[model samples]
Target: MASTIRVGVVGCGFYAQNHLNSWHELRREGADLTAVCDVDPAKAEAAGGNFGVPHYTDAAKMLDAEKLDVVDIVTRHETHRPLAELAIGKGVAAIVQKPFATTWDDCVAIVDAADKAGIWLAVHENFRFQTPMRHVKRVIDSGAIGRPTWARINFRTGYDIYKTQPYFYNEERLAIADVGIHVIDLARFFLGEVAHISCETQRRNPKVRAEETATMMLRHESDAVSVVECTYGARKLPDPFPETLLEIEGETGAIVVGIGLRMSVTSNGQVSEESIGSPLRSWTSEPWHASQEGAFNACQHFLDCLKRGVPADTSGEDNLKTFALVDAAYKAAEEKRAVEPENWRRKA
Candidate 1:
């Protein structure tokens, strides 16, 4: 293995440029950005010039031609599985964007492929890496909140997504896949594996086919219950509704994250509150772009694992649980009943 990891990024769409910028920064720090790939020649060429990397129209050819140690996938949600599988098969480590795949089976297949190939795999579930969320995790883990029994993760923004990406109107790529997955994963980070879920989904925007709002109840394996709410319908508030609000109530105390980044705790008959700053803004103002920074961190972590021999923070297998929660949430909404997490499965 070389001292500097050779990395390549696939996809140059709306969000791909952030990944390119992060990779260039990482390269300056220590890594090597060997090349970039995109189906659109224009995108590939633009990204290549912006990052000063070799360009290719085909990711497979880029992988075959460059001695890459890591392959970053920032393509469409649908392409994540195949691209990740290809990278694993080619003996390269992989860092994939959120909504790992459309279904549980694809997620399972990606995990299995990485496991069999003995390559590191990580999903870029960045919200949890945000400063406020990270502080919340620290408080919970430190037992300041005691043994958490209930929690809530709320993300609501009025920013018209369709105006930025009209494809968001596509029913096949609903709000659940686009934003709900991140909220689901954030809940899981604090509450652990979800055992059951009940959800209500609605398309508030008449012009769009996909759901604009979703509310889900999740029962975690730790016997903790959580409510997850996501909506593009949220009106911008005086105190802007947090892009995320996580409240965890444990046996000893309770902590609220992303609301002024505060954490409250009660222990031994004593109650206290602590102020913390936001961690989600290290990269960009756009939440999605900020998310890309988390993705870059995930990539660096994957590289570190490859170098030192360890497991990734968001391993492919672990992410299956996150996807399962998403699957259950959608099923619960469709059937108008509570759905068991384990009962969620990919269509054949």
Candidate 2:
């Protein structure tokens, strides 16, 4: 990988706008936006025109034509495996957007393919990279909260998400699979790996086809416990629509992220509080800036790893652990019992 990283983007849907803008903004930092591809010609053209790059409807054509160091696949879950496999075939690193894929087998296939090729593959799990979330992790790492023992993480909101993603209205695995995965991932981020997980789900929104609310509990390997909650049907005034409110307790003290991204930490007989909100950027807006900024940070991490010849924190292998929690949550809800997360092993 060179300091001047040549990059190609493979999806141009709703969320890909942020990816395009982030990559464009990173131009000063050495990310050369080489080309973009989408099956929809209009979308491909729009993205390419807007970003001033070549566009293609076929992914294979774009990959064959460009000398890209990385191909950022921002497509939906169902397309992740195939696009990843294609990129692996071309020997290009990929940053896949999460929900890793539609199923555990699909995610495993992508990871396995990348592993076999020895390619740098990562899932775009951006929540943990959010400014406020990073601040929380920083505090924890600084030992301000000592050894984390328990946590309650929630991403409850009634925002009209369907307006932007009407396709989600019919997803078979709505809450837990769609948005709860981020909250669940955050739980794993704050605590350690899960020993086992239990969950209860509900179809709170009559209009939705699947469960829109999920309440999960996890027992961490380190004896820490976490209660994780996610929903798209919460009714609240001035809703914390895109904010993740959490409370983490450790051996020495605790950390809490309340409404408005205000964080409070009580550490070793001392207390401090501040607003740990997302940083404003030219491409960011209210309510969505946290997520937008997180995408930028996640991309930066991937780019830096490519240049440094290292693996990402959210590498394909590591994210399998997070995706396993998702599978475990669904199983727990269905079986009405606590379920251990399924672990993956590389073929010898």
Candidate 3:
């Protein structure tokens, strides 16, 4: 209670509502929902009214007004850089939404700013924080799957995502930037850092402006290989929308995460299988609950770290590695060859 971290959330839009809800749910764990901000007065007023927190149309004003310890940047990718800079500039810790920024350079700039300011900055990359994925990680750590040599992480669905966020149809970097980034992050989470990547992209949906399907091959630094794929073009019965199916093979055994959140592990020739589905919370719903819960879990982790004055698991510096993979994937697709992800820290 005494260690409660006063918090402010910016951008009360479609996806941001999840962050706001999550912060409220985290109050018991010492996250004080101090304020909320958005450019749209109606949206800000609506969220403020519902949450019983003061809302403002200006982020700077809210930051100046509230004695906040942390600020969650839930705005669009383009706004992430400046808003994060604003938070760090004020010496307040910041938690930014994923895709970190619109470009690799911007991502670097934000990380550098946080470093220079000596403030906590973390990216909200929550796919690996999903309940199933956490279970998978625990299995791997327990040595049931030894030295993971190969993995296949898949996210395919035809759910009407655009219906909820129509702006997706016009995004220049559609699928990979939107969802493939999550799958790619999962690849790193399951295996290790990528050594190089080869990818193929498709514009299966005639209506979308950019690629909606991305199939990738990753060579990890450990010489392990993985197939990472995501698409919004699949037309399957009982679509597992928002679920990521996985198959990981190691020296000792294998782990398979299939439809309906079912997971099976083979160790020492013994097979064990069960449902690893995410549970629904009062503020969560079907299909989307897994993702929403992940957001909450990620927020909780960040808050815990902030209170302890430590770097987050998805700290700004660490996420650059994941962002690099996304950048390299697009290049690999264009050239039809493998490309090593860019590392900004290499000595010149």
Candidate 4:
């Protein structure tokens, strides 16, 4: 209950830089980034030097030493559960990045621990927070698109994503778990909770160990059916890398978020179009700005929710639903059938 929330970031690797920058920018909004930690000494030192904060190579040492109100776990999926548990165990709140954990049990354990500790827990699911997606949600909520019926949410790219994070080549669960999870969450955000899901997965890229492409069909609880597609192996002329193009049809109207972030909506027989691209912040760059803006917006949302003492939109419990789709999608593809996403709370 300090005037300013003191934050300690656990990872300082590639994507962690965005979290560090976002925390620094949130200082005016009452975020005090106190410390940074990474197993790699060089990464830790560089982030600390750039951000003017103390650095540590050990997360336990940093967690023990820093009087942090919240710990942001920006590490890989494998480390998420333990890192989150570590922070929650010490009575500090936690915000972990996507793909909550490697498995459903791990995700459940972290949630259970946080619930018992009575601390805030959220997953940084950024897609729903992106500017364009937010606008799409607003249009749906405004009744501009009355009762979204059928939709296609897609994230396809031929961009060389492995250039930055080459470890993707070795991941056993690649496409669906990596980028598809975001689109899947977006589907749930705009539409509603899915009643059942059927998916098809392919290992299109010979270089990768697992499926690099995933196409899922969802039957929402609203009786709406949606097709969600995501792949890193798309080969096309207008490669919309890192952009999620969508088409949503409602009872009265429709919305289409096309390439270059152009959003067209037809409501009540009136058609309108606008460029709803993510604005570039001082600390952000082109192309990646869309995703970086999402990360920043998501962090801001989490910080605000923490201050209000409320569960975030992507709270551990809610994200478990999204995570469940990930598990069900993989199973659906393997079994060649439609599967109902397991309600984690019911199983708990």
For residues 88-114, write the lDDT of model 1, one tens digit per residue: 989999988888887777888898899
Which parts of model 3 have CA positions greater than 4 angstroms off? Answer: 344-348
Indicate the worst ten consecutive residues by lDDT in candidate 1.
Answer: 278-287
lDDT of prediction 4: 0.94
Backbone collision tally, model 3: 0
Q: Across residues 1-348, which tens digit of lDDT does each residue of candidate 3 receive?
A: 248999999999999988999999999999999999999999999999989999999999999999999999999899999999999999999999988999999999999999998998999999999999999999999999799999999999999999998998899998899899999999999898888999999999999999999999999999999999899999997899989999999999999999999999999899999999998888999879999999989999998998888899999988998999999999999999999985744422
Candidate 1 vs candidate 3: which has greater TM-score? Answer: 3
Worst 10 residues of 3 by lDDT: 339-348
For model 3, what is the error of residue 63's alpha carbon versus the real structure, in angstroms, after optimal superposition? 0.7
Which structure is stronger by lDDT: 1 or 3? 3
Candidate 1 residue-wise lDDT at 136: 75
Candidates in order have lDDT scores of 0.78, 0.92, 0.93, 0.94
Give one digit per residue, the lDDT tens place, for model 2 in 72-139: 99998989999999999999999999899999899988888998899999999999999899999999
lDDT of 1: 0.78
Model 4 bad stretches (over 4 Å): 345-348
TM-score of 3: 0.98
- For model 4, which pairs clash? none
Q: Which run of 10 residues does model 4 get worst, by summed lDDT?
A: 339-348
